[model samples]
Target: MKTNSLLLYSCLLTMAACAGKNNVPATETINALNLKKGKTIFCGPADKQLGAVSFKISGNGKVQEDFNMALAMLHSFEYDEAEKAFADVIRKEPGCAMAYWGVAMSNFHPLWSPPSKEEFDKGVKAVAIAKSIGKKSKKETAYIDAIGAFYDVNAKDHRARCINFEKAMEKLHLDYPDDQDAATFYALALNSAADPADKTHAKQRKAGELLAKLGFDKSFHPGVIHYIIHSYDYPELAERALPAARKYASVAPSSAHAQHMPSHIFVRLGLWDESIYSNTIAADAARCYAENAGIKGHWDEELHSLDYLVYSYLQKADNKRAKQLCDYLNTIREVHPVTPKVLYSFAAIPARYVLENRMWKEAAVLEAHAAGNDWKKFPWENAIIHFTRLLGAVNLNQLDAARTELKTLTALHDELIQKQEAYKANQVQIQVKASEAWILFKEGKHEEALKQMNLAATMEESTPKPPVTPGEVAPARELLGDMLLAMNRPAEALEAYASNLKDRPNRFNALYNAGLAAERSNNAGKAADYYRRLLASSNAPGADRPELTAARLFLEKQKTLAVR
Candidate 1:
């Protein structure tokens, strides 16, 4: 009789929690239901997928339905529906952790959303209660999984957001050990947290070394060195990246990700032998992987493996292998649909091949196919599609298409006005402007190009510099300097770089580019000083280090080729 009475009381509390229409907490900034579907479905476009609801959700009934609906709406980005759904969740379970996570997600996703302090606070509050309740007594079954997902975001703000994501992945990896997303997410998180400052910090160095045991190191990916080199404070410490780079190559000899990274790094470091050696290994390993995997893989796997194999061959100028690979690619793609990466890879080879050949029309078609045609099949490489359209259109002299791409990017930039990245938007603007400037240059309109470059400078200037890991400031500054140098205004370029380098003295690109600017101005003393500094620095990006050596050699021959 007592047990029955206790159960009845518990049921009453649950009933009370779900009783009302106005069940949501008032604190969230965005509507939970609206966010659930990401968009509102008007009466006309309503379909079966829109109406589907989860069978697993059996709760204080309506509230559970509301939560699922809200989660779907929010996931879909239909903020209005999500708002109502979350309100229902709150109504059903006033202290439901997922309701708060819903609010948090609606506010805090990386690309599209922005967080409100109120939503963050509410999420933190709910998560706190969730941790204690879910971990201890299994209070609510439906909310636990959602609670765990939101826990991936850190409370301390001490590590990169990726680090928190990695913690979440650890749980997921434990549950679904074979899922590649877990591995990719974990790799990305580690890649994200590693800053150039890590080069200086003993702890980061040890952590980097320890990561080798897990098959991740600087040579495995450029980001490994990039995070450390760019964020490194002691400009000198950036050299530490090399040891890990070598280690990464040797340890993971067969991994596609591992083979080429060391070579890429070596090329940047002007270590020609090492670069070639690593590139060869990467090329061979990829070839082997594709051949081995071909028999077992379905359409997608075969496509993926083939793409990697062809990419390595193309990079090495093995036209025979490239042709063979392309033939195989065409054969496989015709029979079976490949992933977005495969499409992008296929489009990219010809896009780059004719990049110098000026077959904009062919490239445009390939780019469009790669970017679009998703209705008949799954969408592949959505971002790459947009980027390829811009690149290929511009390459093929389809200014109209490139212009359209730029306009869309601008609109996107405007949409993200307050939420623009640390420096990426500025870089994008710089790229668009540089492209415009280059087209003008190609048309023998140096003055127009210079004007376009100046416009780029203005756009780049308007954006604020973000506090990031060491050496990250180079691209913007380099673009600025390159433009100024192109204008033959070495003094201004020098001043521009000086301003940035003063703040991020560890960034060696500034030093190297600064050397080039000095050389252009017939400032021999300054050029030598820059070259010497470049040679002395280890943190220089792999892409630019050869340019640095070239700059030094050019300086030596300056007297011979007097530009009258």
Candidate 2:
């Protein structure tokens, strides 16, 4: 993992050169030099086969080796490395059309953020170079055409060009049924196009079905397993990809994304232990990569992994791990300034620790602006910190502090909306209303508070969930249940908690509150059932939750009385 800023820039500019609309060198000389039709190539390293794909390229020796290596890296979403490798191929064989395609495709970064204008321009230049190389085989021509669709400068929108590229590949795959790379990439396009808001996830389902038909031996292809998990990222679909999720880490043991990717399914399925394991590996990989590469900032993979790691630890009531993670997050900035992704994790870790542990006092007095935490860079993430602060303030009957935090949340909501982050904006607004509801409840406006909280919960339910964060600060309806219980409305509270469980299953806090509500309502059977479920799922130590003790004693007393 060598850090070469100069090489990175050269890769980008050189890649762009291939996309440029300029004179191309004669292709006759290059084409006459090498002619390789098709061969079955093993992906990944020789000792550890990922799978076999029948690929054809017009190159031999080092050119062929580097090209295949570039493809494997691209399949794993190692864009920077792929770009550099492809650039090296260009140096070896300037006329290799598919090598130019590699460079162009690497610039596209299909699974991550859309490419910048310069990247698109460079990709277009690279495609132009491939075309200028002269007469190409039909197979080479199809590959060039697919990437050309991506770099088609006439197509202004990047996503539209991406769709066009996918459509082109669809035809190529249909034409050449044996090309697994084309089929796998086409599946990736479908998964990328799937709308998160559409709960049906029709596109994702189609992608998964396509991968399944390919007879994707999980051990054989990283993309097959990687895309399967991605296609089924949502909670409803997560269980369907459990086998793929479980196997992905082993398939691409060195990939940071591969290490972290399993947790998407794990978190969705509430498999806390598995999630912890996946994230721990991911974080270690990220840390080592950053150190070895001489990368300064907090690595994106580490931050993403830590967010999931913290959430899983909190769920399991591993207070020791949670505290250590929080401390690590606080000190991470000493190494380098936080990126936007790191900022989210830094804010979220503390918020999760205080709120999840029910340490209202710590949350109430938490420093709003920690050193190296740039609120201006990421107001949306800052909203999470404020949300927990507001929660604590409301719980502690600190109306002034609650009001101030609510005001700050409102400002963040406006900023997010202005930035066109509508989903995050809506999320912030929901938190704002939740805080307002809490404030109203403290002011003795019980009816108003319930009405407000109900409205907030409804809005949150209808809105599409945020993709970046591990989870919401807390579900509004669950908060509503807590408030209802505080007001002695146990029956209503129990209903609220139950409603929350329908959408967000296996959440420990909601189950605990629901049990308390049932107990207060004198429904011993329902109380016992809820408590038993909580205890079964809960990893909280004995001294951590007295409610557990109360539930146990009550059940034991009931058993004794029944015996009598």
Candidate 3:
């Protein structure tokens, strides 16, 4: 049956491409490929243009029904809920081998946090239990084997194990050509194994293409859409993901993360208004969920939403709303005990508020010792707090204080390295270098300062900024622009700001500073253009930005002078 279906689909594809249309409708194709469990079938649609994969399983009615529910949650990355649903299936049919597979799969979060030793052991034990059931289908055995590879304690490297699991899934997908879930998970595993530093993003793009075949048919599948968004998250590919990003929240409106996910593309595209709407809805929903669960402090979901919301507000010069969010975050510390996760957001809120608003004076005055409890436990989170303080000291010419903060950042970087957190260690190292460049400029070392700043910028360009924040504390090139302006080099400063804007677009400080730089360089027309864009982005009411007032006055004067 599977072989025949493939031949039929290949003919249809040839006909569609050569003749401009396949006489068979997509609905008919789906109907033809809907084979029962015992029959082999094609994994994905034979017609590449048609984006649906409908694979079904047959078993005891109640157990099969519950297993389907668990699978849906697993596809969407909802591990906790999936675990419960799969456990219910095991309870209903203790001998069901695939139910144990579901439990093991739920225990692994491919990209975010690696499973703990205990989690890996539990998943391995589950696979062992599934093997003991003896009545498992070939497809079930394939899944069990793939998870066994994932928990291979001897492999030691988590990423290498993930790649092994991906390879296993690829073979399973090919062997069971009719299993849509296998194909879907294979694409997900491809992304899980992708290295973000790879500029080609080869695996991510492949994952996106494979998932794209599911198109409108599986539009309601949260994992299909969610994975699509993640696959094309880079600035270069963000345009390609606009459709999926727009549709995901509506597809999974009940999901807090889903509501927030689209904003990733929105932020990349500089669609401030869309980002604002998405995060607002997400934050509200997350708050409701936290209250219902009797959780005092914000959970991970709520913190994620609030972080994005505050960022969007600052981007649009909605300082009032941003301040309100900061106030809300303050309440979080008062209500809940400090966990590492909550501490991350608690540190981020204040840092974002000051930095995004360009409140350099406030940052300068911020006390480093006021850092949240157990700050040392999470050096990566504490680094952001210290970064802002470093920037503030530089801006105020508090050289000694800035040097002290830079030492703190170095300490944090070394600590992260010792803990095997390579990515964050490098991020903090970049901060330290950028601060050093600032100090060089303060010392009137012009040539040395620019060289250090450029080197810092190059290092920054080598890696993408972590997505957890709306923007960097101070983009390296943007700091270079600040140094250029300090040296009375307006034209050169404008060019530097423009370069930074290419990667981090529509940023408030960059936009406003660009305008200032333009005006100082005697380019009235370009200066006016920059100010207009800045004003357009400033949609918040009662926003107290003096720069906003300056831009308004400058633009108005330009208009009056033009009338002369």
**Residue 94 lDDT (model 3):** 58
For model 1 the TM-score comes to: 0.41
Alpha-carbon runs more than 4 Å astray in model 2: 1-54, 116-121, 147-162, 217-219, 334-338, 368-373, 540-543
Q: Rank the models by TM-score, top first.
A: 3, 2, 1
Q: What lDDT does the true structure give each of the candidates?
A: 0.45, 0.74, 0.73
Residue 98 accuracy (lDDT) in model 1: 53
TM-score of each: 0.41, 0.85, 0.86
In the order shown, what is each candidate's alpha-carbon RMSD?
15.6, 6.3, 11.8
Candidate whose lDDT is highest:
2
> lDDT tens digits, residues 445-474, model 3?
988989888888888877765666655656
lDDT for model 2 comes to 0.74
lDDT tens string, model 1, 180-280?
32333333334334442333444344434433434334233322332332222132333555665566444433234345544433433434345445655
1 or 3: which has the higher lDDT? 3
